[model samples]
Target: MFKLLKYADKYKFYAFLCPVLMIGEVVFELLIPQVMANIVETIRLTDTADAAVQSAAVNDIFLYGGKMLILALCSLFCGSLAARIGSIAGMGFGASLRLGLMEKIQTFSFSNIDRFSTASLITRMTTDVNTVQNTFLMLVRGFFRAPIMLITALVICIRKSPDIAKVFAVALPIIILFLAIFAPIAIKRFRAMLKKFDGFNASIQENFTNIRVVKAFVRTDYEKEKFKKSNDALTAAAIHAEKIMVLGEPALILLMYFTITAIVIIATKSIAEQTLDVGEFTAIFTYAFQILTSFLFTIMILVQVFMAEASAKRIGEVLYETPDIKDPENPEETVSDGSIEFKNVSFSYGKGSDVIKNVSFKINSGEMVGIMGATGSSKSSLVQLIPRLYDATSGEVLVGGKNVKDYSVYGLREAVSMVLQKNVLFSGTIADNLRWGDKNATDEELKNACEIADALSFVESFPDGFNTDLGQGGVNVSGGQKQRLCIARAILKKPKILILDDSTSAVDTATDARIRASLRRLAPNTTKIIIAQRISSVSDCDKIIILDGGSISDIGTHEELLSRSEIYRDIYEAQQKGCDDFDSVGGAS
Candidate 1:
C-alpha cells in the first residue's frame, strides 16, 4: 500500500492544502458552540435584571449570536474548499495510477502477460486501482479532521461534563473493539471477492470476444447458463464480503443513539437538581454530537483502509513485476539483414517439456522458405523467437548475424513483419488499418501492397474504397478478405523479412497461388517465411523445412524432400489425394 502511494506524490501540494483547510474548518466549527452557549446564557439571565440591564443583556446576546453565525459560515466555507481540493488530489492520483499501470503492462513480455492473464490484469487496473483511489481520497479528507475533532471535543466534554465524557469513553472502546474483530474478517472476504471478480471478467470477455463462434454453434442457451453461474458466484461472494460492514454500521449507529439517550437523561437530571444550567447543557449536547459523529467518520475510514489494503497488494504485484524479457545494456540498434539461424534451441512454456527441442536451422538472406508441420508441432513458438517475443530456454537464436538478445526489441521487430495465424483488424477504415504497418506510407504504397496481397480488387470494389470501415474485428469482411487485408498491412512495412503463419488458409488455391507469385516477383529482395498446411502453398519455395515432433525432420527444396524425407512425402501425398477427391466431386456435380 505504501509503495503504490508514490503515485500520489505528484499531487502532494493539493493533498497538503486539503488537510490544512480541514483543520481550519474544525477549529471554526468548535468555536461556534461556545458562542451559542454565550448567547443562550445572556438571554436566560436577562429575565431577572432591571429594564436597562435587560436592554444591555440583549446587546450582549446579539453580539454572541452574530459571532456564532460568523463562525458557522467560516467553517462551511473552509469545508467546501477542502472538499474541492481533496477531489483534485484524489482524482489526479487515480489518473496517475491507471497510466502507470498501463505503462508497466506495455513493458511486460509475452510470457509475463501469460502469467497474469489478460482478464486478471484488466480487473487489477480498473477495479483494484479504483478501490485504492477511493480509499486514498477518504484518508486525505478525514485523516486529520476526524481524530482532531474527536479528541478536541472529547477534552472539552471532560472538562465541562465528566458524566457525559465517561459515557463516550466506554462507547469509543466498544467501536474500536468491533473494528478490530470485524475488519480482518472483512478483508479476507473482500480478497476472495476480488478473485471472483477476475473469474467474472474472464467469463464476460471470452463470451463477447468469441460471440461469432457461439452463434455459429447455436449455443446461446449454454452460454447464458455459463454466464449465470459466474454471475451468481460473484454475487454470493460480494454479499458474504459485505455482511460485516452492513451489520456493523447499524450497530454503531445504534450505539450513537444509545449514548445520546444516556447523556440526555443525565443532563436532564443535572439541570433539574440545579447542578447544570440550560446554556451549559445545550453546549454539551452539541459537543457530544460532534465527538460521536467524528468517531463514525473515523470508523468508516478504518473500514476503507482495510479493504484498500487488499487492492493495494494486487496492484503492487503488477507494478513490481520484472519482465522475463528485457533489452540488454548497449543493445544493437540495427538488424542488418533478414538471415535467421536457430542453434540447438530448446524452449518450454513454463516447466513443461520442450516444445521446440534441440532445433537447429538457418535461412539465407532474401530467400523464400517454408515450414510445414502437423498440429501442436510448435511452429508458431519457433518463429516468435526471431523477434525475441520469448527468448530460447537453452540455445541462441541469431537474426542478421547478431544474437537476438543483442538487439533492442523495437529495433529487432521493426525489420520483421509477421501476419499471425489469427488475422486481426481493429474497427477502422481500410486506410487506417493499413497505416499500422507504415504510418507515413503513401497512398500509392498502400495500393501496391494491397495489389500484391490480392486485396486491391475487393478493396476498390467497396462503395467507400480506401475509406470503407472494417467494423469490429473486421466482421464486415469475409475470412479470406480479412486475411488479404492483414497481408496487405504487413507488406506495407517493406520489411527485410516477412512471415505468414498459416495466413493463406482461408483463401482459395487460385487466389493463394496468385499471392505467392506476386510476392516472389514484387518482393524478390525480401526474405519470406511461410508456415502452411497445404503442400502446394510452399511447393515453389527455395527450401522447405518440415518439423516432426519438435525436431527438424528434413530441410530441402520440394523435389529434394519428395525423394529424401518420408515425413514430407507422406504429407504431400495426403494433401494431393484430398485435392484429387475434391476435383472428382466437382466434376460429378
Candidate 2:
C-alpha cells in the first residue's frame, strides 16, 4: 500500500492543500453544533423573562448564531477548493501510475508475460488503480480529520463533567474489542473478492477472444453457462464480503444505543438530586454523541483501507516483476554486413526437452536461406532468438560477428524485419500501414513496395486507393491481402536482414512467384530468410536447410538436398503431387 504513496508524493503540494481545506471543513462543522447548543441553553435559562428583556437576549443570541453560520459557510467554500485540488491531484497520480506500469510491462520479457494472462494485467491497470484512487481521496479527507474531531469532542465532553466523560472512556474499550474481532474477517473476505474478480475477468476475456470459435462449434449456450458460473462465483464472494462489512454498522449501533441509554439514566438521576443543571446535561449528551459518531466514521475508513490494500498488492506484483531476459551492461552495435552465425546454440521452453539442440550455422552477406521443417521442429523458436526475443539457453547468437545480446534492443531490431506466418494488420489506411516500416516514405516508395509484394493491383482497386480505410485488424481485407500488406510493410523498412516466416502461404502460386522475383530484383543486397512447409516456397533460395526432430537434417542448395536428403525428397514428392492435382482440376474444362 505504501508503494502507491509514491504517486501522491510526486504532487505533494496538492496533497498538502487538500488536507488544509478538509481541516477547515471540519472546523466549521465542529463550530455549528456548539453554536446550536449555546442557543438552546440560552433559551432554556431565560424561559420566564419579561418580554422586552427576552427580546433583547434573543436578538443577541441570533447575532452570535449568524456569525458562526457565516464563518462556517466561508470554511465550506474553502473546503470545496480543497476537494477540487485533491481530485485533480488524484487523477494525475492515477495517470502517472498507469503509464509507469505499462512501460514496465513493455520492458518485461515474453516469458514474463506468459506467466500471467492479458486479462489480469488489464484488471490491474483499470479496476485496481480505481481502488487506489478512492483510497487516496479518503486519505486526503479522512486521515487527519477523523482523529482531530474525535480528540476535540473528547476534550469538550470531559469539560462538561468528569462523570459523563467516563461513559465514553468505557464505550471506547468495547468498540475497540468489536473492531479487533471483525477486522481480520473483513480483510480475508476482501482478498477473496479480488480473486473472484480475476476469475470473472478471465472468463469474459477468453469468451470474447474466441467468440468465433464458440459460434462455429455451436457452443453459445455452453459459453453462457461458463460465464454464469464465473459471474455467480464473483457475486457470492462479494455478498460474503458485504455481509461482514454490514455487521459493523449494526454492532456499532447496538453499542451506541446501550451507551447512550446508560448515560441518560445516570444524568436523570443526577437531575432528581439537583446535582446537574438541565442545560449542562444536554450539552454533555451532545458532545458524547459527536464523539461516538466520529469514532464510527473512523472505523468505516479503516475497513475501506483494508479493501484497497488488497488491490494495491496486486498492482505492485506486476509493476515490480523483473524481466527474465536482461540486456548486457556493456553494449555493442552491429554494422550491417548482413552476416549471422549460431555457435553450438541450445534452447528449451523451460524444463521441456531441448527444442533446438547444438545448432550451428553461418550465412554470408546477401545470402538467402530457407528453413523448412515439420510442425514443432523448433523453426520459429530458433529464429525468435536472433531478435533476442528469447535468450539462448547455452552458446550464443551472433550478427556481424558480435554477440546479439551485446546490442541495445532498439538497435538490434531496427536491422531485422520479420513478416511472420500469423500476419497482423492494424486499423489504418494501406499507406498508413506501410509507413510503419519507413515513417518518412513518399508515395512513390509506398507504391514501389506494394508492387514488390504483388499487392499494388488489389490496393489500387479499393475505392480510396492507398488512403482507403482498413477496418480493425484489417478485417475488411482478405487473408491474401493482409499477408501482402504485411510483406510490403517489411519491405518498406529496408532492413539489413529480412525474415519471411511462411509469409507467402496465403497468395496463389503466380503471385508468390512474382513477389519472389520482385524481391530478387529490388532487395538484392538484403539478407533474406524464408521458412516454409512447402518445398516450392524455398526451392530457388541460395541454401535450403531441412529440420527434423529439432536438428538440421540437411543443408545445401535445392538440387543437392533433393538428390541426397530423404526428408527433402519426401517433402518435394508431397508438394509435387499437390501441384499435379491442382493442375488436373484446372485443366478438366
Candidate 3:
C-alpha cells in the first residue's frame, strides 16, 4: 500500500490541507451538542428564578445556540471545500499514475512485454488503478476524519461524565473483540475474490479475441460453458467475501444496541436515586450517538483499507518489474556502417532447446542477403535479434564491430528498420501511418516510398489519396494493400539496415517482382536482409541461407544451393509441382 501512497507525494500539501479541514469539521460537529445542552438547561429552569435572572439566562442560551449554528455552518463549508480539493488531488494522482505506468510499458523490451498477458496489463492500468484512486479519496475524506471525531468525542465524554465514559470503555472492548474475530477472515476472503477476478478477466479476454474463430467453428455452446464456469467461480468467491465483510456490520450494530440499552437502564436508575441530573442524561445520550457514528466510520475505513491493500500489490508488481533486457548504465554511441555480425550465436526462450543454435554470419555494407526457411525455423527470431529485441542466450551479436548490447536501444533502432509479416497498420490517415517511421517525412518523401513499394497505384485511386483515413488495423484496405503500405512505411525510414521479413507474401507475384526491382534500383546503398518462403523471391539475391530445424542447412546463391543443397532442391521441385498442378486444373476447367 505504501508503494501507491508515493503517488500522493507530489500533492502532499493538498493532502495535509484536507486533514486540517476535516479536523475543523469534526471540532464544529462536537461543539453543536454542548450548545444544545446549554439551551435545554436554560429552558428547563426550576424555580422560575427572579424574572431578570430568567431573562438573562434565556439570552445566554440564545447566544450559545447562535454560536453553535455558526460553527455548524463553518464545518459544513470546510467539508465541501475539502471534498473538492480531495477529488482534484485524486484525479491528478490517477492521471500521473496512469501516465507513469504507460511510459514504463513502452520502455519494456519485447521479451518482457511478451511475458505479460495483454488483457491483464490493460486491467491493471485501467480498472485496478481506478480502484486504488477511489480508495485513496475515501481514506482522505472518511478514513482520516473518523478517528479524529472518535478521539474528540471520547475526550469530551470523559471530561463531562464518567458514567458515559465507562459505557464507552466497555463498548470499545466489544468492538475490539469483533475486529479480532472478523478482520483476518475478511482479508483472506477478499484476496481469494481478487484472484478469481483475474481468472474471470482472462477468460473474457480470450473469448473476445477468438470470437470469430468460435463462431466459425460453431463452438458457441462450448464457449458459453467455459464462460459459465468462470462466472460461477467468481460469483462464489465474491459472495464469500461479501459475507465476511458484512459480518462485522451486524456484530457492530448488535453491540451498539446492547450498549445503548444498558446505558439507558443505568441512567434511569441513577435519576431515580437522585444521583444524575436531566441535563447530564441528555448530554450522555448525545455522546452515545457520537460513539456509534465513530465506530461505524471505523469499520468502513477498515473495509477500504483491506481492498486498497490488494489493489496496491497488483499495481506494484508491474511498476517494479525489471525488464529482462537491461540497458547499460552508460551506453556507448553507435555509428551507422550497416555491417552486422552474429558470432557463434545461440538463443532459447527459456530452458528449452535453442531456437537459433550456433549461428554465425557477417554481412558487409549494402549487401542484400536472404534467409529462407520453413515455419518454426527461427527466421523471424533471428532478425528480431539484430535490433536487440531479445538478447542472445550466449555468444555475441555485433553491429559495426561493436557489441549490440553496449549501444543504447534508441541509437541502435534508429539505424535499423523492419517491416514484419503481420502487417500492422494503425487507425489514421495514410500520411499518419507513414510518419511513424520518419516523423518529419514530407509529402514528396512519402510518395517516393509508396512508389517503390508498388503501392502508388492503389493509393492514388483512394478517394482521399494521401489523406485517406485508415480503419483500425487497416481493415478498410485489402491485405495486399496493407502489406504494401507497411513496406512503404519501412522504405520511407531509409534506415541503414532494412529488414523485410516475408513482407511481400500477400502481394501477387507480379507486384512482388516489381517491388523487388524498384528496391534494387533505388535502395542500392541500403543493407537489406530479406526473409522469404518462396524460392523465386530470393533467387536473385547475392546470397541465400536455408534454415532446417533450428540450424542453417545451407548458405549460397540460388544456383549454388540448387546444385549442392538437397533441402533447397526438394523445396524448389515441390513448388514447381504445385504450380504445374494448378495450371493443369485451370486447363481442365
Candidate 4:
C-alpha cells in the first residue's frame, strides 16, 4: 500500500501539516484533565476553610475552569484544521492515482487490455481507489491522533497512580492479540468481496451494452435473473466480510467496559484507604477513559488499513502492468508508402493454437485488393497488424517496405486508416465525430469525405445536417448509417493505406458499389484492402484473395477465381442466385 503513496507527492505538505496539527490537538487534550483535577482539589481544600480562604478558592476554581475551556477550544481548532488538511490531501491523492491509472491504461496495447476485464478495471478505478482514499484520511487524522493521545494520557495516569495504570499493560496486549488474529481473516473476506463487485459490474455492463438484443429476443426475464444472481453474490460477499468486521466492534466495546470497571473498582478501594486522593482519582479515571478510547480508535483505523490493503493490491496490478507492444528505442518516423507484406506471420491470442498460421501475402501501393473469407478466417486479425494493434506472434509484418516495429507506432498508424468491423461513435455532433480522424478538417473536407462514403445525402437531410447530435454510441442512427459515418471519419484521414473490414456490410449492395467507385476516383493513389463476405463486393477488385480457415486458399482476379477456386465459385454462385431470386420476386409483384 505504501508503494502507491508516490502519487501523493504533490500533496506532501498538506499530509505533513495534518499530523503536526493533530499532535497539537493531542497536547491540548492532555492538559484538560490536569486543569479539571486542579479545580476539584481547590474545592475540596476550601470545604472547611475560613470565609476569605473560601473566596480565594472560588477565584482559583474560576481560573482553572477558564484554562480548561481555553484548552478545549484550542484542541477543537487544531483538530478542525487537521481534518480539513487531511481531506484535501486524501482527495488529491485519489485524483492523482486515478489519473495515473487512466494514463497507464491508454498506453496499453489491445493484448494488455485483454489481460484484464472491463468490469475489473472499473472496480479498481472507482471502488478500490475510494477505499484507499478513505484509508489515507484515517491515517493522517485518526491514526496519528489516537496513538499520540493514548501515550500522553497513559503517562499522566501512571504518574498519578502507578498501580491503577498497570491494568492497561495487560488490557492493551489482549486487544492487540485479538485484532492481530482477526485482521487477516477480514482482509481475505474484503478481497473476495471485491471480486464479487467485479462480477456484478460485468453483468451490468454486458446487459446494458446488449439491451437491444435482449429486448429483441424477449429475454428480459432471463437478463433480470442473471443480474439478480450477480447482485445476490455481491451482497453475500459484503455481508460475510462485514460480519467479521462487526465482530470487532462488539469485542472492543466489551473490552472497554471491562477495563473501565476494573479501573473503577481498584480506584474506589485506593480512595477509601486514603492511598489515592479524590482529585487525583478523578483525573486518573478521566485519563483511563481517554487511553482506552484512543486504543479503540486505533484498532478501528487498523481495520480500515487491512481493507485498504486489499484495494491497494488490485490497483497496483493495473499500474504496474507493462504494455505488451511498445516502440523500439530508435524507431523510424515516416512510412514510405502503403505497400504491405506479411511473411510467414503467425499469431495466437494466448498459449492456444495459432489463429493465423504461417500466412504470407503482399499488397502493392496504389492497388485495390479484396479479401474474401469465412467467419473466423482471421481476416480482421490479419489487418489489425498493419496498425500494430497486435503484433505478430512469429515472422515479420512490414508496412512501407519497413518492419512495422521499426516505425513509431503513432507514425505508422497515422498512415493507415482502418474502419473496423465494429463501428463506434461518441456522443457529439456529427461534425465532431467526423473530426476524430482529422481534428482540423474543414467543412468542405468533411462534406467531400462524407460524399465519398455515400453518407452526405442522409446527413444533409437531417434537420441539423452536420451539426446533428449523435446520441451515445450513435444509438439514434441505424446500423448502416453508423457504419457509413465511421467510414467517412476514416476517409477524412486520407491515409496512405485504407482498410475496410466489412465496414460496408450493413449498406445495400448498390450503395456499397457506389462508395467503392467514389473511393477509386477520389483516392486512386491510396492502397485499398476490402474484406467482404459478399463476392460482388470484391468481384471488380484488381486482385482477389480467398482465405479458407487461416490460410489463403487462392489469389487471382474474379474471372480466374471463378474458374479455378471451388470455394470462391460456390460463394459467388450463392450470392448470384439470391440476387436473381429477389429480381424475379420483384417482377412477379
TM-score of each: 0.96, 0.94, 0.93, 0.97
Q: What is the lDDT of residue 398 in candidate 3?
A: 89
TM-score of 1: 0.96
Better of 2 and 3 by lDDT: 2
Quality of model 2 by C-alpha lDDT:
0.83
Q: Write the per-residue lDDT of candidate 1 for residues 295-390, one digit (tens) a residue.
A: 889877888888888889889999999988888999998889999999999998877889999999999889999999898898888888888778
In model 4, what are the clashing residue pairs, if there are any? Answer: none
For each candidate in the order shown, give its overall lDDT on alpha carbons.
Answer: 0.90, 0.83, 0.83, 0.90
lDDT of 3 by residue, 521-566 (tens): 9998788888988777788888998988778898999999999999
**lDDT at 179, model 1:** 74
User: Which portions of model 4 show Cα errors greater than 4 Å?
Assistant: 579-589
lDDT per residue (tens digit) for residues 370-411 in model 2: 999898898988888887878899999998778888887777
Highest TM-score against the true fold, candidate:
4
Clash pairs, candidate 2, are none
For model 4, residues 293-324, the per-residue Cα lDDT tens digits are 99888887888888898899999999999988
Candidate 2 stretches with Cα past 4 Å from truth are 50-52, 273-275, 325-327, 350-353, 583-589
lDDT winner: 4
User: Which residue pairs show backbone clashes in model 1?
Assistant: none
| Each candidate's clash count | 0, 0, 0, 0
